[model samples]
Target: MNTQPDAPRHVVATSADADTVLRRLAREGWTARSGFALPDPAWDVAAHRIVLHGRIADDDTETVALAVLAAARGAGVVAVCDPESAAGRALIDDLSRIGAVHRGTDGADPVASLIPEQRALLDRLAAGDTIAAAAAAEFLSLRTANRRIAEARALFGVRTTREAVLAYLRQRQPE
Candidate 1:
């Protein structure tokens, strides 16, 4: 899990609401905590880079949630929402309405743009014709896709070359 130095700060109307958001986040691999001191007095929950005001539960809910989403966007934190919430549903709708395209063939964020170099590397890997070379490229990177490739290779017991890793990824991909 990517541990931010602090939880992104977000405002929620009540402590209960904050807890709800934090609990949901925990389910999705984000850790949350309260009672931290911030430059602003009303900033209660720090969940990534989001500062939340923890007092008004009536009107501030959506604002805080949106702020949290914005912070996630800014911080490169992929905010997975609880599917049960109206807010989550609305966010999903908004993403689709905007023609957002998600590609996770490399275990990277679907919302993020692929770096040109990485895209080139992924193309080779996906083709499976140059597996050894692609795996070599991923091995030298510090990015998460590289880490996932390494982890997937380890899980599949691939140590030979990128070709071997590509085969593993192909076998694992759904038919």
Candidate 2:
């Protein structure tokens, strides 16, 4: 229910890494995930950074990194390699072309920050109300309402308000 989305995710490709990292991260107060397909459920609010294993100075590694990035759509990724190594530097350069934000624990609880107003707006949006109507229901002006929805759009990394609402529902909803 977080009105503002979390930073890039901290994810692993396997539960083994997930397990170990989870334990270590738990000590440091970081939430983490592992072993999931990069399709369907969006991960923007969950994962903050990606920790890649092995030497990431090759085409294969970049391909893997792109997959993870696609899942969360974050600023940048990190690899468990020698940052000073030639390959590592090259990988960094390649990824920097996209963007890189250090996924931090400040984003531990993606749902913890949902404000009532934002949730109400999303509820209206999910209920199929127009942005104008939804805003009016909340006694807000159209511009203000659009701004809030825009936040949801950016936070969920979707192009449309409907997609953002869907992302909100998927995460906030119970299976």
Candidate 3:
């Protein structure tokens, strides 16, 4: 986690966009590496002029990358998206709602791997009769539920003002 107070915040979501950005950085003599996941990879994120990560959720890509790249600008972040993915859409909406600059081809590309762990969680959340109860059941902690559900909302591109899966849970709950 590059939690520096000053870092460039940028996002590269799709493999293509990432390729463009990374190649540009490489052309500029910015050291770059790409893989499915890192195994205790060690690099001073602050020291690197550019960083690239792939196969991450659209939201995570944007939010985390922004946190890394835009740390100097009050936690700046950027996310690239394929445009066709629901998760990508959600990422765009979430970032846009929060005034984050989202860049990429917005043509919808089915970027659906963002919440592989969330289906069961959403199912559990829907089992309760109230928002708070659903939160309790799904997350077992209000703070955790709040955070996770909000992330889910952003990952799924659900159009609710609360930006939480709890909104779905609450709706499913019988009056």
Candidate achieving the largest TM-score = 2
Report the number of backbone clashes for model 3: 15
Clashes of each: 19, 12, 15
lDDT top scorer: 2
43-129 per-residue lDDT for model 3 (tens digits): 343454444444545445543433333333233233455545755555444443333232543312212322322444566545544
Which stretches of candidate 3 lie above 4 Å from their native place? 1-49, 54-111, 114-117, 125-128, 158-175
* CA lDDT of each prediction against the hidden true structure: 0.39, 0.50, 0.44
Ten residues in sequence with the least summed lDDT for candidate 1: 97-106
* Per-residue accuracy of model 1 over 1-175 as CA lDDT, tens digit each: 6454423332222446456556555665664423222333343333444332233223334633553444434321233333235553443333322222122222233212223334445556667635456656656434444544443343344574364346544554354
Residues 1-175, candidate 2: write the lDDT tens digits: 5453333323223335434544564564444333223333455534444333222333445544553465345322323333345544444444433333222233333332244556789999889898889989999899878766765565566799778888888878463
In model 3, what is the error at residue 111, expressed in angstroms? 8.0
